[model samples]
Target: MDTVMKERDLAGKQREAESINFADLSPTSGFFFTSPFRSLSTEGCLTNVSEPAVDGDVINGKFQQAMQAAFSDARAAGIKHPVLCGAIPFDKRQPSALFVPKKTHWIERSAVMAAVQAQESELPAVLSKTELPEQQQFMQMVTDAVKAMNDGKLEKAVLSRLLEIKTRGAVERPALLNRIIDQNPNGYHFHVPLEQGALIGASPELLLRKNGNQFYSNPLAGSARRESCPQQDAEVSRVLLDSGKDLYEHQIVTEGMRQVLADRSRHLHIPATPELLSTPTLWHLSTPIDGDVLDPQENALSLACLLHPTPALCGSPTRIARDLIEQLEPFDRGLFGGIVGWCDDRGNGEWVVTIRCGTVNGDHVRLFAGAGIVPDSSPESEWRETGVKLNTMLRAFGLN
Candidate 1:
């Protein structure tokens, strides 16, 4: 028994060594996981007085300041091109996780490495059983969302459901978050630590970023999570792109983004069409709208702030979808569906739409997933869609 325990310990150490080596070797490294989500609210450039109005200029101003700070620091460090991405709140909603404990730097490294090591760990060993709704309940939710759309109640809305998970011991969850970081090297991976809250699975869709005179906004909409079979996955992607339901959802976001950029930008180019993007789990139809800004006044952070609760993440005809979301959804989305990213003075940064995410409220964690509802969308299918989205985060936790 001791030999087995020692062997496991040795393996954990080896994983730790590998993770630290990767971090040391990589030219680009910054904070990752939900912890950064909460920390930024209090400690980083995102910390600033918020505007009273939902759509106010205060956030914009603060965001600009944040860009300035990052840029100034980067210039000093001789880092020519620095990319920052993480979540920032739309409404100044502070994290629910009250006080996060400070870990020594080595412990922090361990936390990240431990998450990677646990990727292959058995979930049944860690997760407690929570009764998933019978298939009928999931179907009913779908039916209702679809009926609402038919009745003209929903132009588009992101309806999310919950899956309760129980864990043994102290609920060592961050270890799972780190493995997610291990798998994903393309974008910023963040986890916002909450006091008595949950975690999130976020791959941001909103990129209000700039390089020199080039400015771009990549708006993501319409998604179908990937499956095991490549052929089936390709079919799903094809269907999602061609589906009137999915296209309708994607178009609303594209149009809204174009309008925003046109009104603010100097020279705008509308791609004659929408393109598709793939993440580890799902396929997304993304539209990248670029324009030249003669003024060059808009900062990525503020622009992203204005675009928050977008139709892609929230819903369309903004106000109506928001109203319906509040009225029907059982839970307040908090930061789960909020934007989290960073920016520097050069207008260079990436901000992902907060989806497939959750927050930690102490030992208990709440995770979230949402799906866009259009006229042709089936509630059951949408529910399953969220399930696939949830896997992005759950897999991080080594749940799958």
Candidate 2:
């Protein structure tokens, strides 16, 4: 291991524990976001969910113009400060589900628990699970990807699969949200209603955050499932820190992020090595990055859009990896690997790389998870990684 990794390995071996008491936790509808800086809930859309008029760049094109226009309209309609909040789709061409809410409450997590009135609904028993691509097929897909990488098709690609689940009853969003917050309180927890269902999850990767001229992001990659035994968990974390393949995968993401943000940022601070970040279910190599935006006019949404499809979510050499995903995966990603959070007119907001999340539509819930397939990636390991990553949401529903 390198000197930086060695020092981090010694210091970050212990996992931090966070406990939450649900005295104030409650069920909420509409949109919700809980980060370290602020926790907010907004309801009742004042304007329609605005989408791009033309399909081009995800952030640019008429799409951004339309979003900006929506803010203007909301302002003219007499709202002092309007925030456009929703989920951006995985494919840049796909339409976004952003709108201006009529009411917004910036409250604490405890207050949300206190506001709870509805009883926790019993989550449905699992009827069956139909993987979009079966396990064996997924492994084969991984094999093919490795071959392609060896043949020089691309450096890496993030291949995702959907666990199309059927339950005895419809999945309840509010109850599930409460469970998620209760279990994994430190991550970025979010909810935004969709045309069909709601996008809900607690994500560890912060694509970008804008507070005045300063911006921040925490990107996580190279992860492993936590062991029940403390010693076993520490051993696994150390292995992840030392694994050359994992470190290379992490470098692809952080370095690529630095390159993308270099021009947008006046100054960016990135550590030479990543430290381990623990969620309730897994251990991830995380790099906390921050900087100042070159332009004060840049909205958090636009900056996130600019950095979307990073190697962490997509792959190195983004276009090629994206194309590979299109050809390989059986399902369209939609908003699975996209971003979730809110951006306001003041250019201050937070957006998270939508992972460890799922979509709930009545009796069905399609959960999403992916692994970065590099040259040294193993099909079995990658498959196991996805299962471990899915635990964040699956555990919330009281499933193993």
Candidate 3:
């Protein structure tokens, strides 16, 4: 049996070697995954599979089964430690996962190494595909959310708006991805190709990162736009830390995460206070939570699935917030407010909240941003917060 296994592995490697055709592959046809502050980037796809989450399981048991099959195929192709990438919907159902084996090529660079790099060297000016939401409409949404909070219907709700941008021609996706990497080197930069479109972003919030039994999560909630002046920026951070309403809002997320993770964690460490984290465009109240999993079998994706759509994205009392989002928001949110990253068969992976992200399909791109609406939240201020968030991606397109 041992000899037979060795022979099979040798044959698989031979087949993989013969199948290499770097000249013909499109960037969208392959898989990619990278970690924040890491030099290594995984590329190419050895096998891929996806399925709808039709049952109680959030990760989609069917998808998990399909992943196992893909893993088997990958190993038969002489690949080990296959990695999966893609996004989960705001709704748990209809999640997608792509399994790329360890045999996938690794590139060490400030940018992803791919065929798309050869297509274009120039960046195009961004054009709006849809008008921004009218102030009255957005204000009304904020007012309604505040009313809901006052009426005890919900403690908090995250309301979002979409900004659709287009280009004269297909925006060179690889170029855009590289720009995001260059601009936000400290962020969780990702470029995941989907069946219909691709999800790209630089996320500052880490949903989950698992290494064996150890896990880490950094949830960012209350936010303030960064100021150009150093003094003003420091003042903004100070104000955010002192704001009673913002602190309450931040606590809702931190406490919620503690409750959910505590059961799975043997020794969970949650700070009594949230620290400030900054991106190029905004400053956020962030709490970093770490833990040791009670069960070693519990992997990254499973933990991410358990904590996704946190109060940071949905709101406090998740069920109520989700219902409000469906009724209040005009868009479906597809992959926005979801989680994206990759997990190996061993369950180690890094999944970041799909914030500060845009979906690209050819020349069209849709960007998304949301703000937590508490009782004291201002409609105008919430709208501006989203605008600040959108700037992170817009700047990558050369739009100020």
Worst 10 residues of 2 by lDDT: 10-19
On lDDT, who's better, 1 or 3?
A: 3
Task: List model 1 lDDT by residue over 234-325, tens digit each.
Answer: 89888887878778888887777776666666788767667778778888887767777655666565566666767787776777777676
> For model 3, how does the per-residue alpha-carbon lDDT over 1-400 read when each residue is reduced to its tens digit?
4423542443343232223433333333455545532223445666665564333123446656676677777778777656666677777766555556444543332234343344445667666656346557878989988988887869999999888887878877777876776678667777777776788888988888787787888899899999999999999999999999899999999999988888888999999998889999999998878889988768777788788779999998999999888888877887789888777788777788988889888888888889999988989999888888999988887775
Looking at model 3, residue 123 earns an lDDT score of 66
Best by TM-score: 2
Lowest lDDT 10-residue stretch of candidate 1: 96-105
For model 2, the stretches where C-alpha displacement exceeds 4 angstroms are 1-27, 53-61, 113-121
Which of 1 and 2 is the better model by TM-score? 2
Per-candidate local distance difference test: 0.56, 0.80, 0.75
The model with the greatest lDDT is 2
lDDT, residue 77, model 3: 76
**Candidate 2, residues 179-201: lDDT per residue as tens digits?**
78767867888888888888889
lDDT of 2 at 172: 76
lDDT value, residue 94 of candidate 3 = 60
